[model samples]
Target: MKFRYLVAFVSLFHAFSSWASDSFIVKDIRVEGIQRTEAGTVFSYLPVKVGDTLDEEKATEAIKALYATGFFKDVKLKSENGVLIVEVDERPAIAQISINGAKEFEKDKLLEGLKQAGISESRIFSRSLLDRAEQELKRQYISRGKYAVKITTTTTPLERNRVAINFDINEGRTARIKKVSFVGNEKFKDSELRGILVLRKPDLLSWFTKNDQYSKQKLSADLETLRSYYLDRGYLEFNIESTQVSITPDLRDIYITINITEGAQYTVSDIKVAGEPLLPEEEIRKLILLKSGQVFARQKLTESVKLITDRLGDDGYAFANVNAAPELDHENRQAAFTFFIDPGRRVYIRRINITGNDRTRDEVIRREFRQMEGAWHSTKNINISKQRVDRLFFFNSVNVETPAVPNKTDQVDVNVKVEERPTGSIMFGAGYSDRQGIILNGSISQNNIFGTGNFFSLDVNTGAINKTYAASFTNPYFTVNGVSLGFDVYKRDLDTRPLSRVGTFKTETVGAGVRLGIPIAENDIVSLGLAAENTVLGVFADSPQRNKDFVTEFGKSTNNFPLTLSWARDRRDSAIWTTSGTTHRLFGEVSVPGGDLDYYKISYHQKWFYPITDNLTLMLNGEFGYGDGYTGRSLPFFKNFFAGGNNSVRGYDLNSLGPRDDRNLSLGGSKRIVGNIEVLFPVPFMKDDRSLRLSAFLDGGTVFARNIDFNLMRYSAGIALTWVSPMGPLKVSIAEPLNDQPVDRLQAFQFMFGQQF
Candidate 1:
């Protein structure tokens, strides 16, 4: 194509020289040799018009202008009988684009890339563009570690001066890293350094993790990890000199090497503060994590700086800057650091701007903010406000940014952005248990009803042993002072055939309750409720002696009034799949003296989670319960606590771990103690996923009626999988009772879908 253009240029130059002395007046203009292009389009680009005097300069200008449009392949100007004749050859338009054998990327993605490169349907086709598009496709494949990929483009001419372009791609296998080596390491071994990197050599697990595949982005992140490893270990002057990546001849294997300079480790000699201290010197010094004689760590230094900055921010210094300067003493292998603090002008918030919330009301979000408009800006309060909003679970993501107000040096605007998530759910679930047979349950719930931050739920459950229907509603801001009001109504029918030992009986209960919650602190809540229930005991010919005796004593139906008090402190970072923090709950329920069967129940639950690593967490959970009849009466057997099941000792049958009767039916106990230790980790291939979890657990628990027996305790070891799937949350467990006895029943495998864990 370049040669053709060169030849045309030479011919035009010669023609212009021969006609330089000749000039003619153009009577009319006509465009020829155009198939799809209009004559007016040609005239739009031509420099000369009809009835205008034409010369060599004018003719050359017209031809050059026409060629510059890129729509014409050839242009010529000729004069015949005092008329100007313009000739042009239009470029062929693209009719269709098709990509074949493009397994690495979707066809639409590749086509979009071509479209951006000016090679789409209905656009003028150019050979140069085809070559560029081919190169681009190859680049995309190479980024995926497919260095051996081949792309071939073909153009087929069609009718109406249009052509169809096809791209055939052969994406070869991804290149795998065969070896990764490091240099200039004195304190740590190569293995230790490799453990901190994301890119890894080929291993048995590489197929699932894909860590062996070579990617420039992964390599860059790995390098940063390597740098942080050194900096955090007192190698303050460490540097990565260079890195080299080599590929095999077949483009199937990769080798990586990194060169580094490990400087001498330094111990902190002294730490001091510089610049004006807005607060007390003692308070500022307490925020410093670095101390004399300790090993110098860059991470600790950075944390110290952040702490000082945040402290200043809490004092209304929103734009505070704190820098840590280190002075190295090479001779003594010691380092001295000084924190330089810059407490900028104190600023106030002029306005709070909320966006991205299409469903929820502005006040619904504003109520969660601790930082108020027109108040002095406190970074600590701003962060707390964002976290509180996140804990609402009404949005998928919440972000807050502060920008200085225009023309107001001491004022800033707070912008809060949120991405709303689904707040309503309807679920139907089924479960199988050896003792309960098959159980079916369904529920409809909404956390943010009508975007008012209220909650409502209706639940229905049926099983061989129990049937229940319940409804509840809650208003979080009932009194506008962080007080909550909720109401619940339920009806339950229990067939004691499966649970009773000697004989069979049934119990029917209908109840309603109202609860009030008061927030005393950020993480503490106190709740009080009153419930009234009517319970009827049905006695059959085969009823147990205990059931018949209960009916004979208290009559067939009994009315009771129970008052409940609960105090809880929840500090978990996330309500779902929590990785850290502790939760403590204490609950007590007492039947008033006027109740037919006066009884009291007390229970304490504590859960603690410790993050061991980015992908691993250790959780310890414990529960204790005690229930007995008040006013010198025996404890109501119906109010006893039962242990064993998915939420208890999972290896045993549900509610089957306590004492048993002659018929081998489980009898509920008045006292219960259960403890569990779990090591939670990510699923092997989905380590970064937040919605899936795998855990190994050891559970121990026991239920006692009169005397607590340690020998009767049951122990179980199990592995569990928890996934928050689209349908609902799912829990599956496979457990084995470590101390199974003849009387204990086992449900080794248990799975439940569409239920909250």
Candidate 2:
């Protein structure tokens, strides 16, 4: 009321002053009472100029215009010696803003909000804007269910016509939803309906999800979800009549009530394709999800439209539209839907535009595109191209858009934008195991060297049991047809005398190899390689007799040429987080008769991922290996396969499962089998987050020297977590041996970093 009276008094004084002024001609203009605003600024807003006539109306207009600038709190006009004089009291400038007792949000965030509301430092202050900012701050707290929050603002005057503003905030306790009641839900239980809502009463996971908070936006979204739930379950006429939310007197609890009306369930009586589908009627009809006599589902109807539209898009109809028009028979509660398809135009790619590759070359990305410029536009091909680019692991995000070319009905441009991620790293890593104590390794690698899509790496590792140095280089696009060429050189020294789990021996090897990767299919690749190796054996007095005997028979040093062949087909949607797809790998290695050692090894592995729900995935993985000597020679013991580790069978000691020598030491075998089943899901309350995953797994595997025995396999069950952190991939697991004999060595906990297990 006081502020209103002040405004009224100011208006009346301006009116009286304007009516009393006499007509006069202005000689010059002068401004006073301005400390920060320039005198010319005041003159620029005045309606009366030096030569213009000044009258009672002009006096009124000048004052009004000057006040409207928001720079002045008071304005007065007068004339002296035929000169128009303007005096203004400028509004105080804000010198500083400070927030106190703010715990719910960062101070910078709150200050930014105030700035958006025109209440920032160094700006002319307005009482109205200050009040509005205060209210907005309260509203933000309310959104987080803090109903008892309070904010008190203070202004301290300073020299030079500036003021310091401070906000004293008390962010009270956040209220939790005490009850959520439905008034008219009958077909489905209240519990079942509540399960679909994002908001809920406080529960064990509420601390992480914060779903117990009552937010207006969350409620609105929940109501929409409720409407969709009913409509998707054949209740096409469902209506939400009202919603009510109430807070307790103490502001510690909230209650919600939603009233809804569920109409009679409906069934689909018929489905027909009506418009010019551009394709065969049978083919378009086959895409319809609604069948006669089936319950009407809005979700299926929506999916049917999308499927038909996408089918048309695959056929170069970039802007196809599919509308399902429904006719309702109220008495029988049946709906007849006619899908109207309008295949707008057959369009071709006018251009393929690429952007956002700050480091990668344009050719590197363009070569992965399957959809070519000047060809018919294909949505399928564009999507495939996006997947291919994503699989390169060179980018953090890949986005593709097919926008119509202006003024061209039959042409579209494919715009591909990608967010690049760092593809080069120099990492020094360390790992620990019961047997390998602490192993340290370092590598300098670049997957996209100089933006040319080439790979290069130099690695060095030193451990208590082994030491290695290696160099590798690969050109992923060695040819236009997606063939790859790579070369590797490595030297390794291994000594097993310090380990109790294996027959003790020592070996040194130096090798070099070249490989070629040939693309066999869109998802299949075959690689071939050959390496020349020289290995020297060092047998000690305490070494197993088998190792000493082999050294004596084959001599202290031997030369061998080893060949490798591998084929892989990977279709996982994402290499980082796979939800649905299958991956298969088949590998074989042989040291031909020309080498001092004649042996061959072959292995096959398969992984299948299936989505059990939007938030759950079932993964099945199996591996098999068999290696033996050919041409009258024995398989080298050092080349034998080993089981029982984090990568093989969890819950058992590393390399602890296989045939044991007379001294009860592990002798790794010539045959191996491993199987694993896992149910994978994101962490609780983080279903949409892709960087972390948790899984419950069952694992079984064993190694055999000659015969394969199912009963000899070790089994374990456990839960594991994998996080794709900024530093690298981290995996941790806790397992319980399900069927371990007294002879089996058990290891219940394991973890690895820098790479996946």
Indicate the worst ten consecutive residues by lDDT in candidate 2. 12-21
Q: Provide the overall lDDT of each model, using Cα atoms, as 2-decimal numbers.
A: 0.86, 0.89
Model 1 lowest lDDT segment of ten = 13-22
Q: How good is model 1 by TM-score?
A: 0.93
Distance from true location, Cα of 138 in model 2, Å: 0.9
Best by lDDT: 2
Q: Candidate 2 residues 288-336, lDDT tens each?
A: 8889999988989999998998899888888888999999999999999
**Candidate 1: residue 308 lDDT (0-100):** 88
Off by over 4 Å in 2: 1-9, 12-21, 43-53, 56-58, 685-689
What are the per-residue Cα lDDT tens digits for candidate 1 across 1-757?
8986787688577546444446899899987889988888888988888788998778888878887787877676767788787767788999998889988788998889988888899888888788888888898899878999988888999998889988888898889898899888888999999998989987888888878988889999999889888888788889999999999999999999999999988899998888877888889889999889988878888888889888888777888989888888999999998888889899899999999999988988999888999898988899989998998899999989999989988899999999999999998877654456777889999999989999999999888778899999999889878899999999999886775342467789999999999999988999999989999888887665776788889999999889999999999988887989999999999997777988899999999999999888999999999999867887766777888878899888777888776667676889999999999998998777889999999999979978998898999999999989876677888999999899887889977664455
Highest TM-score scorer: 2
